[model samples]
Every structure is written in structure tokens, then in C-alpha cells.
Target: MGTMAFGRSGASTAGWTRRRARFAGTAHWLLVPALAFTLALVVFPFGYTFWLSLNDYQFGHAARFNFGENYAALLHDAVFWQGLGTTFFLYFLSLALQLVLGTYVGLLLNRRLHGQTVARTILMSPFMMPSVVIGMMWLVILDPSLGAANYILSLLGLPPSQWLASPGLVVPVIALIDTWQWTPFVALIVVGGLQALPIEPFEAAFIDGATRWQAFRYVTLPMLRPTLLTAAILRSVDLLRFFDIIYITTQGGPGNASTTLNIYAYRRGFEFFDIGYASAIMIALMALVAIVVLALMRLRRSL
Candidate 1:
């Protein structure tokens, strides 16, 4: 009887091992399509763009390999430098404003308030809207002559200044428009992080007679480091490649005042048909974005 029981146990163990192996094989098969799709969509385009950057490719002509000449030309290009300056200016300014305002808004929403659900829904609505739609809507609203903004300024006994038309104000206006659309996204992430926090520390803070600001400053801020880092990383990456809002509103003008690197690349490649130079500019922009993201991610990991 004992010998029969031992044989049955050995047979069941072998069968279970075979079943587990089969399950793993099935999982590997399921992942094959996703990996193939990613390669086709992402990897292929990246390789093509890199190849384009290395040659003297232009519209309606055969590409001759020019090695690094395009990148070298960019080093001497005034417009490219101006675009990079604008990109960094808008990126840092918008990110700072968004983080500050988003944190405040997130804290406000976390409170016990009437109509909270409606407020959250309305606040989040902008993030869901297509960026192009936001751009168009704001363009109409910021129009110097017919815009409500100037009309309100007129009513307030103030001057109706040109917003996007003025060189000095164009970059800031673009940043403002972008911040208005994206601050809610930052807030949403903040809210998620806020909710996951342990209540014990705050309760202890309460027992110690800590003020609300004190709790937030001391305890909440420390807890929110990871979320803030995440928001920064995501927002910075998008800002580095900023194009849509400025494209629809300014088209990199009133005379290239709002031209970011992305806009610069578009103008070079599509408008002027400088494919090789544009490819170099775009590749450089991508590299800068990658470096920024990696640095932020490393900071996040440290935190």
C-alpha cells in the first residue's frame, strides 16, 4: 500500500511541473505580438530618423552620406540656438508654475467641501480635451481685437496689450496656455499620492497641536516627493518637445518669437525642405529630453 501511494505522488508532481511549463510557454506566445508591434511602430521609426540625420537628405533628391556635417552646421546656426533658448525658457517656467499651482489645487480638492465631485470633474475636463482644441479655443480667447481678454482689460481701465503678437510676451503666453491645460494632470497625480498616504502621521501631528500648514509642510511634503518627481519627469519630457499650442497660435511667429526646438525642426524640414538638418535638430532634442528624464528618474529612485 505504501509503495503504491509513493508512485502516485511522484506521478502528480511530474504532471504539475509539465502544466507550469506549458503555462509559461503560453504567456511567452501571448507577448510576441505586443513586442512585434512595438518594434514596428517605435524602433523602426527611431532607426529611420537616425539614418536620415547622418546623410545630406533633401526633398526630391538622392541622399548622400555627409557624416556629421548637419550636426556641425547646427552648432553654427543662430536660429537653432534661439529655438533652444526658447525651449528651455518655456520648459522651466511652465514646470515651476504647474508644480506650485497643482500642489495647491490638489490640497484644496482633498478637503471636505460641497460639490467636490463636480469640481473635480470640471477641473479634470481640460486634461481630457485634445491639446489642439485647447490651442484653438485659447487662440480665439486671446485674440487682441475681438478677444474677451482685451475686452475685460478695457472694462478694468487697462490697456489691451497684444499677447501672442508681441515677441516678449509670446513665450510666456504659450507657457501660460500650456500650464492651464496641464496643471490639472499634475493635480490628479498629486491627489493619487495624497490618498495613498498613511493617516497615522497626520493624526499624530494633530495630537501635537500642529497647524494645517505645518502638517503639510513637514509631513505631507516629504511623503509627496516621489509623486512630485514623477510629475516633473513627465511634464519636462513633454515640454521639451512642445509644439502644438505654439504651432496653432503663433506658428513660431510674430517672427520666430515662440519657436521651440520642435517648431524649429518642423520649419526646417517641412517649410524649407532641409530634411537632414531637421533630423539632426530633432535627434538632438530627443537626446536632451532623454537625459533630463533619466536624471529625474535617478533622483526619484534616490528619494
Candidate 2:
């Protein structure tokens, strides 16, 4: 009986080892297609962009290797620098507003109440709308002459203000449009986080006489930290390449007040037909986004 038992245990261990080995081999086989796709689509284009950045490549001409001229020209260009600053400003402003408003709405939606499904659907509708449509809608709403915003201001005895036409207000208006579109995404992520949290700690806190705010502060916020960071990082990445709404709304107009890094690059490439210079700008923008992503990933790891 003892000999039979020993033989059975040894066979079981050997079978487990074989299963793990086969799983590893299958995983490697599965990775081949993904790696090939990355090399073909992502890495190849990335390397090509970098190479173009170092050349004065033009249509119908052999690419002239202009090593560092594009980078140097970008340095002395005040407009480029201003656009870069505006890009960062807009990125953060949208991120900040989305986080604040999204958190509020997420908390409200997490409650057990009637019509929650309908309310969530209604709130998320804006995010599903096309960017061009949203921009056009806002244009009419904020039009200085015939917009509802100014009309409301007039009703409140306030002077009608140019929301999008004025340089000072253009970026903020763009930020508002972005917030309206993306807040629901953040709220949805937060709601998922809230739902996934363990209820025992919250129940214990309540039983121990903790107030609602205190329970949230000590129990809920701590649990939601990782989710919030994840949402912020994702939003930041999207905002870094914010071009759709900006392009549709302002076209970086009214004297470059709304011009961001993406707009600047588009103007350089398509408008002026400086393909090499635009590629250089794009590579730089990619670097900036990579840095942000790396930083956020590190923060996520620490959390």
C-alpha cells in the first residue's frame, strides 16, 4: 500500500511539471503574432519617424540629411514654445476638472436609487457624441451674437461675453468641452472601483459611530486610490494628444491662443508642407507623452 501511494504522488508531481512546461510553450507561441505586429506597425513607424526627423525630406526629392536643423529651428521659434506651453496647460486643466467633477458624479451614481440605470445612461450620452458635433453644438451655444450662454448672461443682468472668440476664454472653453465629454468615463471607472471595495470595513466604520464623510475619508478614498490614479493616467494620455475638439472648434485660431503641440505639428506638416519638421515635432511630442506614461506607471507601481 505504501509503495503504491509513493508511486501515485510522484506521477502527480511529474504531470504538474509537464502541464506547466506546455503552458509556457503555448504562451510563447501566442506572443509571436503580437510581437510581429508591434514590429511591423509600431516599431517600424517609430523608427521611420525618427529618421525623417533628421532629414529634410520633401515630396519628389531625395531626402536630404539635415541632421539637427529642424530641432534648432524649433528652439528659436517663439510660437512653437508658446504652443507647447499651452498644450501642457490644457492637458492639466482638463485632467483636473475631469477628476473633480467625475469623482462627485461617481459618488452620486454609486448610491442605490430609482432611475440609476437611466441616469447613468443620460450622463454618458455626451461622451458618445462625435467631437465635431460637440464642437459645433458649443459654437452655437456660446456664439456671441445668437448663443444661449450670452442670452442667459443677459437674463442675469450680466454683459454678454465672448466665450470662444476671445483668446483668453478660448482655451478654457475648450477645456470645458473636454470635461463634458470625458467626465463620464472617469465617473464610470470610479464607480467600478467603489463597487469592488470590500464592505466589511465600511460597515465596521459605520458601526463604530463614524460619520459618512469620515468613513469615505478613512475607508473609501484609500481603497480607491489605485483606480483614481489609473483613470487620471489614462485621461492624461488622451489629453496629451488632444486635437479633435481643438481642431473642430478653434482651429488654433484667434492668434494661436488655442494652438497646442498637436496643432503646431499639423500646421508645420500640412499647412506649410514641412514634412521633416513636422516629423521632428511629432517625435518630440511622443517623447513627452512617454515620459508622462513612465512617471504614472511608476506611481501606480508604488501605490
Candidate 3:
């Protein structure tokens, strides 16, 4: 009886050990599925795109793996370079105007004045509209011959200028559209940030005989920096990949005046069906965007 009991006890102990090991093994197996999912979805696709950038892949015929040739070709491609420059130009111009205008509007709305709520609602409505719809709406309003803008200018006895028809005017007009649509978004962010600020500095400045401008310059501006930088960084990232409004309105055209890097890549891939070249351009653009974001983040941290 004692021997039999010892054998049963030993068997039970071994069974418990085996159960714990199985549980740990199951957990390890569970991790495999998650890792596989990430590799299949994100890592694999990214790797493939990088590989395509090294080849001369087209829609048909034998694709050649021409290492670094596409990147070299981009250097000689005047249209591509022009588009890149135009993109940067538009980005900087719109960013500056939007920051200034949006901040001012935010300040105004934050004031304890009559009809402030109504005004805010009206201003923010534009931002809620779809980009394509905004583009179409602006097309009518900016129509040179018969639109409201031209009609008003005509009433003032000025010549009816071709707003978007001229290549020189196209990008500026697009910037205007962007500003109108996005300024309210910036303003809303600023207004929220302003409301959250401590009032002590502002009150102290006022007590020390600081005029409104002086108080703003000394107290308000310093306090607003972080929020402003945050808004600017977010806007910059969005503007770098800007596509919808440009696509809907200009189609990167009237002879490539408003063409930006995004539009250029689209043309290369879809219009021309040069996948490898387009992939190279896209990788380059992504790198540029990543660098800009990193710089912006560093600057924010320093501030």
C-alpha cells in the first residue's frame, strides 16, 4: 500500500509540472500570431516598396533592377525638381499666413464679447466641409468672369483678372483656399489653448502699466508658444502630404505651375505607370517629411 501511494504521488507531481509548461508554451505560440500579422501587413509591404524603388518596374515587359538609376534620373528631371520647389514654397507661405491670421482670430473669439459663440460656429463650419466640396465651392466663387470675387472687383472699377487660369496665380489661389479652409482649425486650437492659460501673468502685466500690445508681447506670446508650435507642427505634417485640394482644383496643372511633389508622384505612378520611379520619389518624400517632423519635435522640446 505504501509503495502504491508513492507511485501515485509521483505521477500527480509530474502531471502538474506538465500543465504549467503547456500553459507557457501556449502563451509563446500566441505571440507568434501577432508577430506574423505585423510582418505580413506593415513590414512586408514597406520592404516591397523599398525593393521596387531599386528597380525599373513598369506596367508591362521585363522589369530591370536598375540600382540608384531612378534617383539619379530624378536629379535631371526638371519637372520633378520644379514640383518639389513649388510644394515647399506653398507650404511655407500658407503656414505663415495661417498662423498669424488664425492666432488673431482666436484672440478675438476668446474675448468676452456679444455673439462670440455664433461667430465661432460660423467660422468653424468651413473646416467641417469636405476638401473636394470646398474646392468646388471656391471654383465658383473665384470664377474670373462671373464669380463673386471678380464681380466685386469689377464694381470697384478694377480689371477682372484670371484668378486660377494664369499659372502665376494658380498656386496663390490654392493657398488662399487652403487658408480659408484650415485657418479656423488653427484658430479653434489656439482659442482652447488660450482659455487654459493662467491669468496671473496677464494681470501682473496690466498692473505694471503694460499696454495691451506690451502685455501680449511679453506675457501672452510667451505662454502661447507651445500651443503655436504644436499647431504649426501638425499643420506642417498635413501640408507636406497635401493632395486633396490640389487634386480637386488644379490637377497640378496649367503647365505644372501648381504641381507639388505629391502630385508629381501621382503623375509618375498612375498617369505614366512608372511604378519604380514613383516608388523612389515616394521614399524620398517620406524621408524628407520624417526629417522635418524630427526637427520640429526637437525645436518644440528646446522651447
Best-fitting candidate, measured by lDDT?
Answer: 1
- What is the lDDT, from 0 to 100, of the residue 2 in candidate 2? 91
lDDT of 3 by residue, 87-198 (tens): 8888898898899999999999999999988999999999899998998888888888768989998889998888878899888888889999999999998999899999
Candidate 2 worst ten-residue window by lDDT: 54-63
TM-scores of the models, in the order given: 0.90, 0.91, 0.86
lDDT of 1 by residue, 95-135 (tens): 99999999989988888899999999999998899989999
Task: lDDT for model 2, please.
Answer: 0.92
User: Candidate 1: global Cα-lDDT?
Assistant: 0.94
- Candidate 1, residue 187: the lDDT equals 96
Q: What is the lDDT of residue 76 in candidate 2?
A: 92
TM-score of candidate 3 on Cα atoms, chains taken together? 0.86
lDDT ranking, high to low: 1, 2, 3
TM-score of 2: 0.91
**Per-model CA lDDT versus the true structure:** 0.94, 0.92, 0.89
Error of 2 at 243 (Å): 0.2
Between candidates 2 and 3, name the one with more favorable TM-score: 2
Q: Write one digit per residue (lDDT tens) for candidate 2, span 1-303.
A: 798899998999899899999999999999999999999999999999899989997656788999779899889988889988998999999999999899899999999999999999999999999988998999899889988999999999998898889999899889999999999999999999999999999999999999999998999998898999999899988998889988887889789999998998998888888889899889889999999989998998998
